[model samples]
Target: MKKYVYPSEISGTIAAPSSKSVMQRAIAASLLAEGESRITNPSFCDDSLAAMRVAEGLGAAVEKKSDSVIIRGGINPVTDTLNCGESGLCIRMFTPIAALTGKRMVLTGEGSLTSRPVSGIEGALGQLGVSVKSNNTLLPIEVSSILKGGTAAIDGSMSSQFLTGLLMALPLAEKDSVIKVDNLKSREYIDITIDVLKKFGIRVDNHGYNEFKIPGRQKYTSTDIAVEGDWSGAAFLLCAGAIAGSVSVTGLNSESCQPDRAVITALRKCGAGVTVEKNVIHVKSGSLRGFEFDATECPDLFPPLAALAFYCKGETVIWGAGRLKHKESDRGAAIISEFKKIGGTVKIDKDCMIIRGSSLTGGLTDSHGDHRMAMACAIAAMGSSDAVEIDHAECINKSYNEFYDDMIKLGAEIK
Candidate 1:
């Protein structure tokens, strides 16, 4: 779908969307738990839904409600083939879980997820006595045998997601497991995973992000969990407020382990009016100035940070461009190419993304089938001199399905 966003001032408050990262992890944990688990404030986004489907495919009885999901856990494997539906996390995280069934299972995904690398999955699972075969290190991976668990080594530089799977699945192994990680990135995401594991009565010992120790013969105890608001999606709204007008976003935890909470720090650094009162975060337009942010641990912040930087006075430099390569799209390249269409100056140098602050003379942009790219372009368009038309605007449904509606409610002129 294509949508045009015109320059307009926005005001009023909106509730942040539920965190799919948390919701998906909770779903995986619930699938491993023996009893019924109730998850409140869940996100029904595409990725989360993919995780739910995978949970159900692996023999969990899932019941969806208006605002919650009830899951009764088991790993009986109702089908040999599980479709992950364009969710990278689902394919990577659930591969290990599927091996717990001790049955031959095929894990496949659609769209961009099909092309994403499954580098560490095969090697790590091999060490744990699970046979894994992939499409030349990509998706549509086949797994057989059980996760007996022992010592495994994986490189964590590309992503910490597969490691999260190990941490979650190893506890149920017949023997204790130890994972040695090298060059680990996105450590905060592991924190979120461990936090979710704790809720399900699972335990893991982390040794300086380099290794994890898990005791075997542990059982997951199901419990009710409440999903927190996503800082990843809320960053775009806050950036919109910083560029156009005032916006107060509620439902975000003041202290979240999610790395995107650094958005607040970035806003303050860029001279935006930011006030935090418990769960409510208010950001207002101010004399915006360039800021420097190292997104090494929070690479998802790149898009919104890029948008926010466009309206600043000088130049903003965001580090960690190297991490954007294997995302939904080549995020760094997409951001630069799309923003160039809208009169924004952005360039990537080595591991840094440099954006020169300027007023947006909007034109047509494209989401490149990336959710964050779509939201960033829309937010950046709000302060443009002309309307910015974005192709593939519907892509935001992956993470924030109501993003356009929320912007419209906040007075954005979108058509």
Candidate 2:
């Protein structure tokens, strides 16, 4: 249980963490490339690591150098059981991908991931000729018989990540296929997947997130892949800069299609002075007034936005709290319990979280083994009466493994 007592203000040049989302996707792409891929500036986060293990289990040879990963694809099933740790993306995305291979593999997970439903996977994989079995759609999935490659209509309103895995894995099938989706949400995340697939020499005919055409027997051609920075994790640092002090976060692309890129709008609305140029976003503290934000499309931004709202005047209401129920933690409940430890007000009204921000009374805080919670608490401690103490602080490794080290570089006091 590491604790941190962050100072009132932080002023420094902080390099934004690498995008775990991009890194995980790249690993999957590399596995399909059937060649050596040079992935530079990769994330060692737990989710990314889980994706790596999945690729390795599929027979790809992966080697790490300095900060780059060299993956040579072409794998045979190494084990019948795979662990996704606590990565929702890895599980939702990989369940379909693992079915691409006929070998029977059981997908099991630990922690909060265990509670997430996997029954949808059984249905989706079944449509593609894979036999699926689950305990009421929960973890410990048993998938067998390689997909026959045909039309599969999937329900996408739940999570776009499941579709991403299917798109990536379907290319290797013996026959072309189409995925008809209904109520597809997070269209931006699908765009991110398509962009990454294009980099690896794969193509998907996207019909506005509702329909996708995947040409079978296509190959994933590898190239020099450099993953972009993470807007999700960067949201926290940018908000910290807006609330505590001036910060220059280098390596975020403003033109990115990441759903959480909407964080910039939240910052600007909260009265944070910001400048975005190319891959850099600079933020400085200013008069933080409470602002209402709609985070339905980019639900991951809830925690960071909540942290930003903690410094705003009056009450801050962020919509889309209902989308947070099945995340790494029950983020809705976790936010309320943890934020209250730092002396703030958090209430759940239907589908929104209202945080009344002022001067925070910092004390012991818990991360609840959630990556966002750990970073959000650290960010909230910026203007706290006392340095905030964080428990289960190591959870940041799930996304930004170097988060604590980077926070230290910005002059945080962690003990």
Tally clashing residue pairs in candidate 1: 0
List candidate 2 segments past 4 Å from native. none
Judged by whole-model lDDT over C-alpha atoms, candidate 2 comes out at 0.85
On the 0 to 100 scale, the lDDT of residue 93 in model 2 is 77
- lDDT, candidates in the order shown: 0.95, 0.85
Clashing pairs in 1: none
lDDT of 2 by residue, 1-415 (tens): 7767666577788778888888888988888777799899988888888989988887889898778999998757788888998998898777777887788889989887888887667787788888998878898888889877798988877688888888888888888999999888788989889999999989899987778999998888987789888999888888888877888889888998898989999999999999988788989999999999999889889988888898899899899887888788889999999888778898999988898975688888888888898899888887787888888888888898877777667666666
Best by lDDT: 1
lDDT of 2 at 369: 87
Q: What are the per-residue Cα lDDT tens digits for candidate 1 across 253-278?
A: 98999999999999999999999999
RMSD of each: 0.7, 1.4
